[model samples]
Target: MTRSVPQRRTLAAAAALAVACTAGAALSTAPAPPASAASPASPAPSASAAAGTASGYATENGGTTGGEGGATVRAGTGTQIHQALCSRAGTDTPLTIEVEGTVNHGNTSKVSGDSCDTAEDKIELKRISNVTIIGVGGGAVFDQVGIHIRESRNIIIRNVTVQNVRKSGSPTSNGGDAIGMEKDVSNVWVDHTTLRASGGEDEGYDGLFDLKNNTRYVTLSYSVLRDSGRGGLVGSSESDRSNGYLTYHHNLYRNIDSRTPLLRGGEAHMYNNHYVDVHESGINSRAGARAKVDSNYFQDSRNVLGTFYTNEAGYWEVSGNVYDNLTWSTPGDKTNPAGPDPESTTSVDIPYGYQLDDARCVPDIVSRTAGAGTGLGESDGRC
Candidate 1:
C-alpha cells in the first residue's frame, strides 16, 4: 500500500510501546488501529509478490509431508475415521484419510450441561502424526461435531465443512470449537475448509479454529470463518503465551463479533484476507502478542485491529491494507494508535516461498479464491 503521508514518528511510538510493555504498565494490550493507518483503497501487489502456496508454510513445514506419499483410506462413518487414526503404523508414516457423507458425532457423544463426553463426540486426531484428513469430493460434513487435534504433528485438514457444533449451549463441551488443537501440537495446515455456525455465543457456539497450549507452526489459508462469537485463539490462556507462530491469508471472515482469531503472546502474520460486517471487534493481539497485519480488506467492520478490553499491551506492524466503509471507536487503550501509523513494519522471518496478491485486489481475489471448494484447484490456494 502506497502512502501519501510521510512516516516520521512511527518508530518512536513503537519504542514507547516497548517501554510501556516492559515497565508492566500494560496488563493486556488489545488496541484498535488508528484511522490514519489505512486509506479508502490499497495498492495491488507488484509483479513479484509471493503468495503462500500449498508447498508453502501452510503445509509441509520444514519438509514434513503429512500423508503426502501414503496410501489412501476412505471412511464412510465417523467411527471408521477414528479407527483409522488409531490404526496408523507409526507417528511418521503418511496416511491420507478421505471422509465421505455426513458424519455425525451426536450418536456417540452428548452434551450434558457444561460438559460433553467429547471422548465419544469428536473425531479426535490424537497420538497421530504425518496425517492428512481431506473430504472426498464436494460434500463431507461434520455436523454438530468437532475435530480435535492434540499432541500431534504434520497434519492437514482440507476441503471439509464443519458447522453447527451444538452441545446444548455449553462452551466447554467438545472443546468449544469446530477445529481445536492443544497440548504440544505442531505443524498443521487447515486449507479450503469451512468452519461456521448459524448462531452466536448466546446460542452456545464457540471458535472456528483454535490452537492453544504450545501449538505452533500453523497456517490457515483459503478458509471461511463466519457467523460465530469467536473466530479462534492462538494461545488459550493469559499465561499460555508460548504458542503462536501462525499465518492467516487469502481467507474470508464474515458476520463475526470478535477474535477473528484472538492472539495472546505469540507472533502472528495476517495478510490478504477479507473481513466483512465485523460487528464488535477483530484481530485482538494481547498479552505481549505481536501481529504483522498486511494487505487486508475491511468492509463495514468495527475495531478490526488492535487490542481491546484488556490492559496487556499488544504490538502491531501494519502496511498495504484497505479499509472501506469501516467503523471505529476511541475506547480505552491498546485499540487505538496514537500518532502517524507505520507505512512499513518490522520484518517477520517466514521460511516458506509463495506469492502475494496485491492489497487493492484483495476484495475481488479473496471472494473468488477463499473458502472451501474454490481457488487454484490444487491445495495451493493461489489467487
Candidate 2:
C-alpha cells in the first residue's frame, strides 16, 4: 500500500516522548526522561551560562544564536509535550531537533483517546534562522503542521512524514496542511517528506503543504502529497504587490480534493511529477501567475491542465504527453476537434503530442516526459 503522512491528532498523542524546554525559571526543573530511555541526558547549560560563554549552545532574549545544538526529543502524548521542546530551544541557536517514534495529543485517555484539539503545530520555528529539523528511521506524525516555519530563513526540513494536520474538529477548520511556511520566510527546502490527510469534515483547506506570501527561493522535491481534502501542494501571494518564486518537482500527488483556490503569483515551475485520482484538477494555474507545467504523468486525473480563471498573462507549453483514462473539463464540440475552447486559449501553445496505451498518461513535454515513458507512440517533435 502507498504510504501517507499520519494524522496530527494521532501523532500528538502517540509521539509525545520528546523533551521540551521553556523560557525563564522553568528551565530550572527539567521534565522526566522518556519511558523508553534507560537514562536521559542532563539539560544543556543554564540560560545565563550559555549566553556568556563562547560554547555553541548560547541563550539570547530575542537576537539570533549560532552553531548546531543536537537535541533529541521523544514524541510524547500531546501538544504540550511538543510545545515544551520548541520553547526550550529558547529561540536562539539554529537548533537541529531530531524526533523519533509516535506522538499523540488533543484527545485524552492514553489508550482510548479520540481526536483532541488540533495539536497546535508540533514544532513552531518562529523568527529564527539556520536551523535543520531532521527525522530518522522511526516515523513521526502531527495533528497540525509537523513543522510550522514562520518568519525564519536558511531552514531545511527533510526526511519526515507529517500526516493528518487539522486545525479543529469543525469542518471549516479541518485542513490537514502538513507543512505551512508562512510570514515572510525564505531559503527553505522541504524534501523527501510524505504528507497525507483524509476523512475530515472540512475539505476546503486540506493541503499537504503551502507556501504563503513573501516567500522566495523555496524548493519542494521528491515528496508525496496524497489523500487530502484540498490540493496536494499550493503557493500564494498574500498581497498583490508581494513577489514569490516556487519550484515543485519530482513529487507524487494522489486523491487531493481540497477547494482552496490555486495560487497566482510571481514565478512557479512544476515539472516531472506524477498525478493520480485527483478530484478537481491535476494541476491548476490561476490568478495571472506564470507557471510552466511540463513532462509530467497524469493518470485517472480530472482536469489535466486547467488554466481557467487566470489573470497574470499566463503561458503554458503542453506537449509530448500520453493521455489515458483522462477527461478534459471542456471536451471540444464537433466543429473544433482540438478542443481549444475560446476561453481556454492563451498566448501560450498547448499542442497534442502522443497517446500511449499503457495505464499512465505521460506528457510529451521535453522537460516533463524525458524521465518516464508512458509506452505510447514516441514523439519526433520537440516539446
Candidate 3:
C-alpha cells in the first residue's frame, strides 16, 4: 500500500502499525442442552467447537482463556444466560454459553446466586471469571439492552450484536453503554461483535464500548462500532487514570462523533482499523495517556487523532497511516488536532509481536471481516 507523505514535527522516524488479527476458525452451532442441564458435557474441541483464541493485549497478564475446558450450554433468552452463570459451582468454574436468539429486557432478569452479581434490565457478568458468551445459530442480539462486565476477568464475548441501549428516557441498561467494563476488569477479549447506538447523549445513548476504573489487559478486534456520539473511553475521567494496556485492531468505526476511544492514562496500540465519517474528533488520547497509532485508514473524518477537551495532553507515536478527505481543527483550550499532517510526539515499545497489514488494504479488509456475522472471519494476514 502506498503510504501518505511522511510529515514530522518532532523526531524524524517512520512507524507502521504492527497489529495482529484476533480470530479463530468459525464455530458451528450445536444442539443446545436443556436449561436444567446447565453443565452439559463439552463438545470435543474442534475448529468448529473450540472457544475462540485470544490475541493482542488479551494475551498478556496470564492471558484470557474464557470457558475453555468447561461445559457448554445454549441459551435463547436473557434469563437463561443468567441462569447458566448462576448454575456454575463457583465464580471461576469454566462455562460457555452459546446464544441463539434475541436477549432483551423482556426476556432477561436477574438471577441471584453466590456465583453471580446481576441486575434487571441488563445482562450482567459480574464478579466472575472464565466465562465465554458467543453467538451461534441465527445469532444473538441484545436489543435495547447492554452487556455489563464488572470486577471480572478471563471473559470473552464474540459474534454478538448490542444496540440502542439508553441511560435515560424509560428503559436503560449499562448506563447506556452497549458493552461496558469497570472496576478492576482484566484479560477480556471481545471479538467479532457489533456495538452501536442511534445518537448522542442528548438522544439517550452513551458510549458503545466503555471501560473504566482500573480495567486492564483488554483487546477489541474484528468488530464494528458505529453510528454513535461516543465510540468508547478507557478511563471515566482525568482522575480515573488507572486503566491501561489496551489494543484495538481490525475494527471499523464509522459515523461517530468522537472518542474512537478517549484514553486517559495507559498505553494503547491502535492499528489496521478503518475510520469513516468521524464528525467531531477521533482517538482522543489525553491525561498523560500514550498511544501507538499505526497503519490505520482514516477517511472523511475530522481531528481523527490527538488530545481533546483537556489541557493535560496525551502523547502519540504515528506512522504509516492514510488520511483522505479529513479536516483539522485549530488547537484551542481543549482541542488538539493531530493532523492535516501528523508525526510522532513520543515512542512506545510494544511487548507483543504483531503483523502489519498495509494501510491501503485496511478499509477493504476490515469491512469484510469485521462485525457479528461473516462467520467470525479474518484476513489472510497479508497485504
Candidate 4:
C-alpha cells in the first residue's frame, strides 16, 4: 500500500509559530511526581472517544479499539492482573484492567489459566486479544517488573511507569525491557507512559521499548524513555526484518546511548519527538528500513540518523527537523551518518493525518505533553 510521496511542504508557517507559547500552556511539563503521577478518573470513554486518542499506525489495520464495550476491573498487583485475564469469559473476551499503586516482583507472580499464557516476575499479556491496562488512582508503577506482550492484538497500555528492570541484576524481567512485544503482535497502543532504566547494557539494562518478530501496527505516543544504553529496536537483527508500520510521536528520549531506536527493516513514521544527550547514536535506520522523519528536534546528540555498525543501508525522507548542538562522526565503512546536514534520500507518503508542531518548540511541547499522568494531556497541535 505505497503511495507516491507528496511535494515537500514549507516550514514557513511553522517557523512563524515560534511565538505561540500559549498554545502549549495546557500541557504539564512538571519534573516532580516522577512522571508516574496519579491517574485520570475512570469509567473511561470507549476507544474512539477517549482523551489523548491514538493516532498514526495504531489507527490503521481496522483500528485499535482495545477493550471497547467490555467489562472493567481494577488490579493493584501483578497477580491480580493475571487473575483478571484468567477470569475472562473467553480468549477474545474484551476487558479493561485499571491498575493503581505499585506493582513489583514481590506482589507479582505467575497465574496459570486457560485464557492466558502467564509467566513469573513479569506482567504477561500473551495469546489473547481485546484488553486495556491503564494506570488509575494514585498511579501504576511496574517497579523492577516489565510488561511483555506476545501473540496478542488490540491492546493498550496508558499512563503507567515501568523502570529499573534489568537482565543481569538481582531481579530481571522481560529480557530487561520496560515493554516488549513480539511474535505476531499487532494493533497495540502505548501512550503517556514512562519507561526508564538506571544505566546501560553493561549495567544490566536492555531496551526501554522494543519490538520484534513480525510485530506491526503499533504506536507509542506522549511517552518518555530515558537513561538507558539502548532506547529500543524494531527488529532484533539485520536479517530479522518482518516488523513494520510503527509510529513514534510526541515522545521524549533523554540521555539514551543509542538505538533510539535501531530500525532493521520496516516503514516507520517519526515526528515531533525530542531527543537529548544521545551519546553514541540515534535513529539507526538500516537493513532497508524506510522512515519518514518529520518535525523532530534532536539536541546534544551524535549521529542522530544513519546506518551504523553495518554496511546495509536504510533510506529516510526528512523535513522540518531541527538539529541543535549536534556532532557528526567521520563516515567509515561501518558508519554512515546523516549529518553535518541531512537531506532526503527517499520519500514516504503517510496515510493518516497528523498535526505538526514547530520544530523550534518541540522540546517544550514534548516536555509538557509526554509521560504518564497529566490526564493523558495532548497538544492541540497549535504549537
Candidate topping lDDT: 3
Q: Candidate 1 vs candidate 3: which has greater TM-score?
A: 3
**Model 3, range 116-171, lDDT digits (tens) per residue?**
88888999999999999998878889999899999999999988999899988768
* Descending-lDDT candidate ranking: 3, 4, 1, 2
TM-score of candidate 4 on Cα atoms, chains taken together: 0.88
> By TM-score, how accurate is candidate 1?
0.78
Better of 2 and 4 by TM-score: 4
Model 2: per-residue Cα lDDT at residue 323: 39
Best candidate according to TM-score: 4
What TM-score does prediction 2 earn?
A: 0.59
**Tens-digit per-residue lDDT, 297-322, candidate 4:** 88878889988889999989999788
lDDT (0 to 1) per candidate: 0.68, 0.45, 0.84, 0.84
Better of 2 and 3 by TM-score: 3
Error of 3 at 72 (Å): 0.4
Q: Assess every candidate by TM-score.
A: 0.78, 0.59, 0.88, 0.88
Going through the candidates in order, what is the number of backbone clashes in each? 24, 54, 1, 0
Off by over 4 Å in 1: 1-56, 59-61, 106-118, 170-173, 331-347, 375-383
Off by over 4 Å in 2: 1-92, 106-122, 143-146, 170-176, 200-205, 232-243, 258-261, 309-313, 331-383
Looking at candidate 4, the ten consecutive residues that score lowest on lDDT are 1-10
Our model 4 lands, by Cα RMSD against the true structure, at 7.5
